[model samples]
Target: MCGIVAATAQRDVAPLLIAGLKALEYRGYDSAGLAVLQEGEIRRVREKGKVREMESQYLADPFPGGTGIAHTRWATHGVPNKVNAHPHIAGHVALVHNGIIENYASLRSELESRGHAFTSETDTEVMAALIGERLASGKSLLDAVSSVVHELEGAYAIAVISDKEPGRVIGARRGAPLLVGVGIGENFLGSDAQALIQVTNRMIYLEEHDVVEITRDRVRIFGQHGEAVERTIHESELSTDAVERGEYRHYMQKEIFEQPRAVADTLEARIGPHGVLPNIFGVNGDELLGKTKGLHIIACGTSYHAGLVAKYWIEDYARLPVNVEVASEYRYREAVVPDGTLFVAISQSGETADTLAAMRESRRRGYLGTLAICNVPESSVVREADLKLMTRAGPEIGVASTKAFTTQLAALGLLALQLARHRGLDDARYADLTAQLQSLPKKIEKALELEPQIVDLAEHLIHRQHALFLGRGAQYPVAMEGALKLKEISYIHAEAYAAGELKHGPLALVDEDMPVIAVAPNGPLLDKLKSNLQEVRARGGELLVFADGAASMDGNAARGSILRIDGGGDFIAPAVFTVPMQLLAYHVAVLRGTDVDQPRNLAKSVTVE
Candidate 1:
């Protein structure tokens, strides 16, 4: 994923462009660059590092202009360097792009044969050169962009500026996310709404194959066939404070702490005086649940782990068989869609490439209905799905995804309750579940109080070369999520298995050198989980246990380290236990001196397959 922002305004746009790029830094941060129209020519500035480095270099030797485009790159094509950064310029045209160009190699060869000299190693530069060549032959900016998009193959959200058209910019999107910001005397384009919310809350999200021409006071949209198109402008509800780190050391930590409010916000509408409300899953929610005989969920990364947890809840409460599949793998293989199957796609940023493709592939296989549970209302998956549930976790700036994951679980919990009600759940059971869901925000608050203990535990694992996370039932997914968080941020080699399955193969590696982390909340499986811990202890494997306050630590007294966490309630323990694991990963990464927010080789969103 890369971040793209363009603005044409009456005042100098460098400051706004730079600020927007900073807001979108979580999407990509390998390199930063911008292109401004100055003195009737394109002035380009780029640097090989974070946006702060590029901003500092620009302030030292500034370029002034009222129209510009900027980018923060995750570096898909070439090594992360100035030559591979965005805001790539070719002749009079400058462009910034997100997503991949599959046909760039062929196009670059064709352009080079036609005597067009290439400078950068990025595919974005090839696209820019193609547009510049078309513009050089007398086509208008919009025409050149429109022509080039048809020739290109792959997902891309691109913004281009040409000196031939002094105050005009053109943007196009195929399969990646792109939005146009509406302002008083200016207009903007960016890959994310958070990047544009500070300047303009009103935004127009471009659909597949839509191209937009933006000027200082006007914006015109066109379809792939060059016909005029109309798109609605929606006002964003995100506040500026949501994107700022505030007093937190990093956005990851701030987001981890913000889970309480974020989960509360997600539950604000689903729960009421009686119980979980009806139609929380959009218009025909009750009817869809009634007709649904089975459920299938597709997602990637943290969202996939969220789906795995939901599989347990849905099958337990609604008495429906559930299947959870990785979105990327699900899209490639032939799917088995049974009769009356409800297909669900889960994604934090609705633009996840594999999830969107999987949703389409599932639709092609003829499911009864499709549902999208996502944070972004205007995302592609949301627009394509028949039913929608918005997580409302405002602007998760951290790449590690703290608030978004918990909020998705909150939404899924509401969905399970609603579906169970349709399956003839009694009012008392409904009320009990509702009460637990309503109490979750405060329970999560209590969980946050265990941060000091988690920090201490993290201190012991920072130097460990490898680790194992063990859980069972619902906690198995929790264990997988913990392992993912550890490896994602700390770069520690970590793996997870069901505690009962530890004796299968992983127990062989369980010695004092490799620490074993267990999820031991008080439940029916607690004794069995303890037995699994005993097995590890027998082998002298160093252990870290996250246990509930009610769970007895006497058995684990002489074995290894034990940290007590508020189990919240029976149904809500997963949400509560999730906090300490997040804190462990966050603190461990901090101690290891690794990039907690922007881990190497990972982007916030997977916009390319």
Candidate 2:
């Protein structure tokens, strides 16, 4: 995902644009650039690395202006380099963009035929060229952008500045997210609220295919059909302190430690003295649950793993058959839609392109209704969902998810209990499950106490090139998520398999260099999992086991090491066991000198397919 921040102010806004890019650094980017209408001309500066490098260049020689647009580019159409950075200019137009242009190749060819020379191999430059072509035809900046966007066939959020217009920034969004920050004596445009939090908090989230025009004194919006429109301005809930990495080495580590509070927040008010509240999901959630015969869970990345865990919970507790599918594949293939099945989509930042598209496509496939379990309330998935369960994991800034994943489990746990009520779950059993959830925050705190042990355990993984994770039953998804964390942040090749599947094919790859990690909570599968560990031990694979305190691995001390997590039992152990996995990844990535928060080539919010 790329980040965009633009401003039309009464004063010079170079510093403001740079600060906005710095705030959006967590989104992940490979290059940074800015363009300002200064000194009666459009001046542009771009660098191939971090925003700090571009900031340093701006400090040495500033491009002070009353109107400007800035971007942190995550390479998509081309490689990450100065020549491929954003703020690509042609004629009088300077533009920065996020999202892919599906018809860029054809448009580039047509633009070239019109005597337009392209400088960079980017779809965004094609946008600038097309808009610049319109500007040459005596069209206004707003008209030029609006006309050019009609020809582009894919998702994009673009901000444009024309030297012809002194104090104006025109922006538009199709499938990607874009917002306008309302400020006195200034108006701003950004990819999200975080990019403009330093200047203004009140924002207008643009609808799909909406175009906006901003100046220091006025704001105008056009609907998809070129008709004038109005949008509500809401105050952003994000605070500056929420994004700061205070008392932690990286955002990933801070998010890992914030799971207790995040889980508590997601569970708050949903659980009561008796059991989970019926209205926790929405006003009509209880009715929806009553009619739901099955569930189709759809998501991507960590959220997809979350759906895999929910499949086990709903089937066991609610007695409902469930099907979980990756959103990217779900949308492309022919799927049988079971009648009375509720479609559920999970995403941390609900802007994930594949998941959002799948949710939209579900409308035509005859699902009962759509439910969104997400963190951001303003996101597209939440806005479009028929019902919503918000995971109150405030502002997850890490590229690799931690608190968001746990909060998702907390939300899904509530969903399971609610559905169980409709299936004749007894009061006593409901009370037991509620009590387990109520005490989960305290249990998560106890799990955090194992960080020092996990830090010590991480020393064994720092030099290793590969790792294997094992779990049975619901913990299999936890194992999958743990392996994803290690590979994402540490650059270690990792794989996860059901403990029972070890003898199938994966056991052949086990050796002294391949470390095997297992999630062993005291459950029916504990003994079976131990047998699988014995198989690994026989092959000389080092064991790094995260076991419950009661599930003892008495004789395996010399194989590798064991970190016992405290107070983990049925239903909640998956969430509790996830803590050590997160901590282990954090410490190993730190020890290996990797970018733990913003890993290479990975964007936090995937806005492009």
Candidate 3:
């Protein structure tokens, strides 16, 4: 949830550190600060806003030194205030940290007993304080840091600088990302590749519980015990457009509209003119279920919703039994993954902490080789998986993901069809499905024509306090995600249910003031969903219908208005479905004066658990 960039070099390093922080601005931050060790002491500057705010402060009184650590924090332990910002300092050690320390309270209590007065609410402050306390006992800097390692709890990628060791920056990672940039007589350490992408793409991904000691001329990697380990540097090829948001009000809106193009782009690159699908991986699909057999899908948030959409495609087309599990919870259960088990991991970043951890757990038990469907090519998930597909989504900057999620559905839907063909499905039906897949973009464009009215509908519901989205069968997951989007950015109270389940419980929440949004596509379930809408109408509930062309409305229906979308084919529904829901959330948030790009209490990348 925070950004960290540090450089320990033989030459001046302040300019490079600032550039790296600018590159990581898209990850999100609330405050910015930097610390440098120079002239036998540590100098620091921190501010409560953007990096620019810190920059202005630094210009007045810069922390000039060869070795330094910086942070762009998204406040968790304290409010976004100057005193709460990072680059917390001790007597001789200055440190910056990412991720939370679960046991900081107990640590703080112990430090307080030792006469270490706390100044900030941040768990990071405890790190510096602990190191200071240990150093007061006359321990070496390395020993002081190493001693605190055994006492700290929770995930962190941390960097420390000491006046006594002015030429080096000692760093370590337990869960969050940390990289070492190799340069002649200079070394770089950062939380993300983007932070160091401009300076040098050549770097090594630090492993779990690894301590990295960086100096002006050398970078040493060590195990938690200080045992030496050799690491290789891999080059990064990041495109300029990967970070720029061209000609859009916000990244969320741009990503929402990028869906059709992103889907089309993934198809052009992965699928051949001959209709053969990408690799299905050789792992036994049944093995993932503990020999009971079937595919086990793991993902988090938006990607998990995409997995749910793919659930329909796999079951309907391939006749394969499939189960979708949230990656964060997948490992906790004794899921008996059968032999030949196919584990499908869906992620946009492909670096989602929980999902990546789950994928590693699956590999540990000898499940079938995993398949990764992700947008980023060199991402951790893609690198670890046996087979992978890149969604070619360029870059999705919105905290509430739009393009990446849709493109994932498109790619996974194609994966499902590919598996069906491999399993000896009928050629004619496959051909029809292929045609539908190819025709999805045009239908998505037709759906975009309804956007202006969607903006209007969102404006209508903007002031309403609560909402419900309902769908049946394949569209059930679509309903779930639509509700998620509304609640994510707008801070609205929203929930989703199968249209058929209204009578069970969700119906009780419907009233004149509460609006119900229905995902009624032109299919067998359309009439069933329509009947549910009428049921809501009976209770005086306001209904906003997002429907296919076939969902007819009588002249002047009193309870709701029907917004028609071109539902050309069966497979096209889910691909084109999320467009309206995205715009609805976008417009509603716009009307409510909310920041659509970065919502409250959220970060674009969930790098820390």
Q: Against the unseen true structure, what C-alpha lDDT does each candidate score?
A: 0.90, 0.93, 0.82
Instruction: Summarize candidate 1's per-residue lDDT along 218-246 as a digit string, tens digits.
Output: 99999989999999999988789777789
Candidate 3 lDDT over 1-609, as tens digits, reads: 688899987766777878788777767788898888778888888998889888888888776778888999998788888888989997788899988899999988988897888889989999999888777789877778877887788888899888877798888887677888888788989988778877776878887778888888888888878789987678866655666678988888888777778889878855554564444333443232223235888999989999998988888888778899999899777788777678889988877888888998997776766888898766678878877778888777788988888788878867777777767679888888888888877787787788889987887788887899998887889989999999999999899998999999988988899899888788877667777888898899988887777767543237777888877677768767778888999899989999888788777778666
- After TM-score superposition, the amount by which residue 190's alpha carbon in candidate 3 deviates from its true location, in angstroms, is 1.9
- Going through the candidates in the order shown, the clash numbers are 0, 0, 19
Candidates in order: C-alpha RMSD to true structure: 1.4, 0.9, 3.3
The segments of candidate 3 whose C-alpha lies over 4 angstroms from its true place after superposition are 9-19, 78-80, 105-115, 130-152, 182-186, 223-225, 278-292, 363-366, 550-558
What is the alpha-carbon lDDT of model 2 when measured against the actual structure?
0.93
**Residue 318 lDDT, candidate 3, scale 0-100:** 80
Model 2: per-residue Cα lDDT over 1-609, one tens digit each: 899999999899999999899999999999999999997899989999999999888888887999999999999999999989999998899999999999999999998998888889999999999999899999999999999999999999999999999899999998899999999999999998999998988999998999999999999999988999999999998998998999998989888888899999999888998888777778888999899999999999999888999999899989999999999999999789888999999999889999999999999999999999999999899999999999999998899999999999999999998998899888888888888888888899998888888888999999999999999999999999999999999999999999999999999999999999999998889889999999999999999988889987877646988888874558888888988899999899999999998999899999999
| Backbone clashes counted, model 3 | 19
TM-score of each: 0.98, 0.99, 0.89
- The weakest ten consecutive residues by lDDT in model 2 span 563-572
